[model samples]
Target: MTASVLLAADNLGVHVGTRALLRDVSFSLRAGEVLTLLGESGAGKSLLAQAVMGNLPAALRASGSVTLDGTTSRADDARARRPRWGRTVALLPQEPSLALDPLMRIAPQLSETHELVRGAAFDQAEAAALHDLEAAGLAASARQYPWQLSGGMAQRAAAAVACAGGARILLADEPTKGLDALWRDHTVAMLQGVQRRGGCVVVITHDLRVAEALGGQLIVLCAGQVVERGDARTVLADPQHAFTRRLVAADPARWPRRAAAPASAGAPVLSAQGLSKGFGGKPLFDGVDLQIRAGDRFVVQGPSGTGKSTLGNVLLGLMPADRGVVRRAEGLHATAFQKLYQDPVASFAPQITLGQSLRDVAARHRCAWPAVLQHLSRMGVPHDLLARRPSQVSGGELQRVALARVLTVQPALVFADEPTSRLDPVSQQEAMAVLLDALDERGAALMLVTHDDDIADAVATQRWRLAAG
Candidate 1:
């Protein structure tokens, strides 16, 4: 008997203006199977998902066939595919925070989806959808607004909504990004459960470990074309193509180890005493105190909802503390936030090139532009990228650029929040090495917040845990 194909994209192509985002891409998803799309940033992973969902932007054009339930069609047939769209294929985009509305309650969004997709009354479907939420590990989140939920909770809620709609084929873009290890494992298990129930799932990610964990089948994409496709384990273990080999070789878990302790003694660079923060009659952190000496690579680790990122924010002055004090012995400090808040396209003034942005930041701190450019080179950002606007760069490049800007300021203390969460393993290593080396030269202190143990173990001179009581 022939295997059933739940979804298939044959010879698909997508073009944004004159640039071809994806070309001649082909893949298929079967019931009870997961096909992970692995590639670096700018490899068209998200764009492929959009093309499959018929949600490509207005400026882009798509060709070839995207078939659901064995029915093949072009862009013009999108309307005909509408009724079966959400029910047959559901998409979970990157950045759940942006995906959800801050003002809307979770239940209302579910009710609205049910009404629009199934033509069912809100009251009628509320009970069943809540059951779905419970199964998806979001039982108590019904009444909460998006902002009220933790990052992991919000991602799970988004997944619950997709599954609750009875979608047979799930397209998840970076589903585990920014989640703690516990939540990441749980989310992957839930998706596996979906596959066990005879559903099809496709996960788009740059993290090879995520793909390895969700083993079924794999398709490696580079520059919009498939470079390798086979059993997940086999492809990863013995990759043939140069790009695939490089990806497998670049796993952060396999990176070379660096001595955790610094050889030199230096003065205390940063100190915090009796740090405390509370919200809604509950304490997020209580009397948390820590100090960092020069040459120290300190790491802060914690589970979701435990306020690790919150503590980072308070230290960086992005958010204020309810009580206690944070003091930096050195006047210079730079921070890379866990979440990307600034508009990438407008991160720098439209009129200014990327190089100018770097120069402006360097000048503000009395650093020379030549030194800044050299620093950027060490971070693997070519001078050509400096001539381009932030909008012209991919998410990973944009993040590196942001870090480059921070480095240009020549800070004596640096705080990096989940800096490698969205970066591919190779880029993560390169970025970390550059940042650490620069800090060492300036005798600066480093404070890193992350969920990855490998990262904590590799770079930290001191490690601390935040527990949820």
Candidate 2:
């Protein structure tokens, strides 16, 4: 007998007026199986996912019927909500910090979400919340607020929320966006747990590592159309579509050649001596020392909650270290320091337009308008997109804009915290190459924090791994 279809979407199309974002997307997902929608940025992966969940934005129009385990709904309903579907469907949203209530503690939040999704008693949900946290690699994050989480931690906690209510059909958008290997493994196990319970999962992701880890039927989308659909191993080993080939090739894991880092020459630009930091009297690292010389690509790597992000802040003088000093040598590149955060949205001003943000950064260094425009053009940002807010742009586009913002400043030291984590492999490769090449041209230093080992291997002249507490 054929596997039962848990969800089916037919002739789905999304458009804003005349422009089509997605068209003719049709797929049926079987229960207990994982179906991954794989594509590059703006390739209509997320749009299709949202369409299936009946969560399209107001301005866009969706023509489709989404059937969930027998109940069907129109895709264009703005009132489409999670609770209305209840345990029949659940979504692990794309941005964890945005998905959560910043004022509430994570424990209570998880319990509440569990109760809402599963229709369980509050007491039972509260008692079982720890298990969800543990599954998401956040046993200690129960009492923490959304603002306190690292990008990776927030992603995991969001996973906990998506799975908390035992929803049989899981719709996750880039669920492993900021996670490291250890936590990523845990997430994979969590998904498997759902499968073991005879549930279905549909994941939208740019990272091939996620697809490989989950072992699913892969559906490749490019420019709003499905180009290829096949078993994971067959398609991954030999993709039938050019877009799929490009995506598969762009993965640093599959890259045959890599650029060699320039020799670490000249005087040390930044030095950390016996640097140690802690929260609530617990030390994250002790007696840690390192020197970043001119042109050195220093890669800091660790699993989730290993204090890698904290280390970046402490080194950049944004936060105080409890035990040591971060020394900087004066008189170098035009701008002394700049950082690209894991989540660029937080770095952007809510009221500021994208163009203004770039110009503001440039003006800080006495940069000219012509130079700013030149940089913006090189980054492939249209003049029209400049007027939009950060929230209006896609994650990949926002990241590229952030890169444009930093490069225009021409800083001597570049600190990139998970710079390309959310980008599709093609975009990730392109963005990192641009950042590294720009740094080289200006004789700058880099302190890159990433969970991607392939990235560290490709870019780092030296590597540092922080131990988990």
Candidate 3:
């Protein structure tokens, strides 16, 4: 007998006033099945997830019906489904930093979810929480606060909390964003575990590898409409839509290798000596010496929790090393040193519109507004998005805007901490092009952290590999 549908969305749409962000999006998932949503940045993929979760932003409106476990409810009435959030339906948000509570530690958060949402006893909840963290390879991070863990660690922690409620239907949005290849595979396996348990999973991601791995249903969206829908393996292997083809082609693994930029023969823009750092008494790296010359591209690669981001922060002078000295070239404006954070949303002022934030950056750095506009245009970011606050826009959109803002300062060096992690394949290519082009024009140096080996190979003039200490 055919299994019943566990989750279904009928003619779902999202809007802000008269502007349609998503239109007529629909899908259905049964137990032991997976549904993957694929699209470029700002293509309404996340909006669709929010519509089904009944968690759309207050400013935006949703329309349609969502059926879960044989109960149907209007998508727009968020309150009607509030009680279903954890045990029935759970959403693993795109930004783990924002999803986690700053004041709380990791283990307790999972335990609480199990206790409150799943109605498990205190002892069982605590044990289950520990087990979940261990399975996610975040056992060491169990005692750490969300802010204390690295971006990848926090992401895994967030996944544990999201699933602790034993929800039958999971909506995971970019769940593997900052994870390394090993952890990425681990996350996919975790999702597969959901399938083994006869639960349904809906994943929204730009990673083709994920969709191909899941090998279930796939839906491709473009400009707020479904351009294609079919089997994941079949569609990804032979995409009919032009946009889908471009997306598939844009994967970094398929990109042609370019000769790395030649070593610059000039004064070093930044230098560090005998650098060492650690987290929670664990040494990440030690006695690391480095020199970054103008126009040089340095890519840092390592497994998740190996302190890839910590090294970047240390080099950028954002955090002090346990033992190290960093020297910058004299006479360079402090503003000339900039960073693109791993989490772009946290970098912007949440209360203000994106336009106001960019305007402030332009004013502070004395960059012409026209230059900002030009950067935005070149990156394919529409001007109308500027009116929205940071949280109102898509993660990929905000990442590009962050890059544009960084370029406005004309920085002498950029410490890019997974700047393109949130972007789609196409947008990743475009954004990287703009960034490298701008850096080449300005002769700026870049120290980048990335989990994508293909991207690191394509972009790096030099490589820095960190090991777990």
Candidate 4:
């Protein structure tokens, strides 16, 4: 690699014992430019970033030459690599909440990081932190704790922290994972801000639209191998590899799938009349009316931090509605109601294996072990995954398992909150098809809550959009 290239990874490879996770990966990123790494799930995108940061999983062994600026650091040099992390290379972590101190406010956390990384005085760090938050479009969230900010706001805060370190090379992972269109656009602009300042950005994402938005060189990886590499427009317009073609064509809007068919109206099977909910003396949504018949795909679409999830809870009687009543069929039992939660890790006990969790669901719903296994198999989940815990498997695999566990109930109505949030594009399409087919076979009514416009359009039989206010 030449001296002009700011960050270069040459022949980088990662292996867990004998199993290769990343093979012969090579790329270079320069200042005032952005590089996009496009790949499906399990393509070692995150692992590559870990290797560059000199901190990978404990089980994995990295073999590669990572050069940041003019200094080269070997992957095994733990001591020598420590000083270069926040000083020369910084990471915009995927989960901001996990990265930040939960007990501290955003300002304090950013200021502390600035003080440590930039060696600034307390007053200087505080001023710089506020400026970074403003640049991140989160000035109002300076005093708010991590728990108080919305998903989009929290992501911006994380970006601000990475930038405040004054590192020349910035790495962002899935920067717009769960954002609405407005927030997604804003985030695009925020990432562009770094480029405007002549810094280098390497973005790791599976979303083709996000890759196109960043307008950079594209490197497509599959099965720990680089399958294609080219300019963004050239690659998207004319993909040479089959895998790249599939990714380019994985457009939910252009997919040949029918919208959820509406059920003929009679007596409403489920009805919410004048539903109102509030938090902290502020009304989230009020005077909302909804009705669901058999086979109804009721989509609750809105921006993040809206009352979509709360509305789902109220309808399921998990939480009380402030000024309304949810009337369901009088004879509906607990078996008739089920929920497919967003975060499967939080849903299951960490100590228990996925096999044990599935067994519990099977017993509660009177489903046979064979039937549960069949459900998991249909969602592209291998049987061996049953022996693993939530942490042992990927978030995508956990999502599929979560779907299978809930489907074993065979409910009359299902509440799916961001069910496909963790899945890659190809897996997302496959998983959604499986979910829709399962629901259709049983004629189950679905109340789906999400911020993705494409997902909202793909599955919505009827749309109920909540206000940001």
Please, what is the TM-score per model? 0.87, 0.93, 0.98, 0.91
The alpha-carbon deviation from the true structure for residue 141 of candidate 4, after best TM-score superposition, in angstroms, is 4.3
Looking at candidate 2, the ten consecutive residues that score lowest on lDDT are: 77-86
Candidate numbers sorted by TM-score from highest down: 3, 2, 4, 1
Model 2 C-alpha lDDT versus the unseen true structure: 0.81
Candidate 2 C-alpha lDDT tens digits along 189-258: 8888888898888888887877987877889987678899998777988998998998999997865435
Candidate 4 residue lDDT tens string, 1-469: 6787888888899887798888988888888888898887668787788788877767778887888887777765555666887778888765565567879999999999889989999999999999888876678678889876655567678777877888888888777776778877777787788788777888987667778888888888888889999898789889999998887777565566456564673235689899998876767899888888877888887776677777888889888989988899777786687887755566778889999999998987788999999998888888977887776565667888998988898888989887877677787888888888888887778888877777778777888888865
Error of 3 at 420 (Å): 0.7
Each candidate: what lDDT? 0.76, 0.81, 0.90, 0.80
* lDDT string, candidate 3, 1-469, tens digits: 1238899999999999998999988788898999999998999999998999898889999998988877888989888888889988999999998679989989999999999999999999999999999888888888888889889999999988888888999999999999998889999998998889989999998889989999999999988999999999999899999999999999999876656666855569999999999876889999999999998898999888888888878877788999989899999987788999999988998999999999999998889999999999989999999999999999999999999999999999999999999999999999999999999888888889999999998989889888898
Look at candidate 2 and tell me the lDDT of residue 350. Answer: 74
Considering every candidate listed, which one attains the maximal lDDT? Answer: 3
Total backbone clashes of candidate 3, pairs 3 or more residues apart or in separate chains: 0
State the number of backbone clashes in model 1.
Answer: 0
Q: What's the count of clashing pairs in each model shown?
A: 0, 0, 0, 0
Best first by lDDT, ranked: 3, 2, 4, 1
Model 1 poorest ten-residue lDDT run = 335-344
Could you tell me how far off, in angstroms, the CA of residue 409 lies in candidate 1 after the best superposition? Answer: 2.0
Model 4 TM-score, 2 decimals? 0.91
User: Alpha-carbon error at 95 in model 3, in Å?
Assistant: 0.3
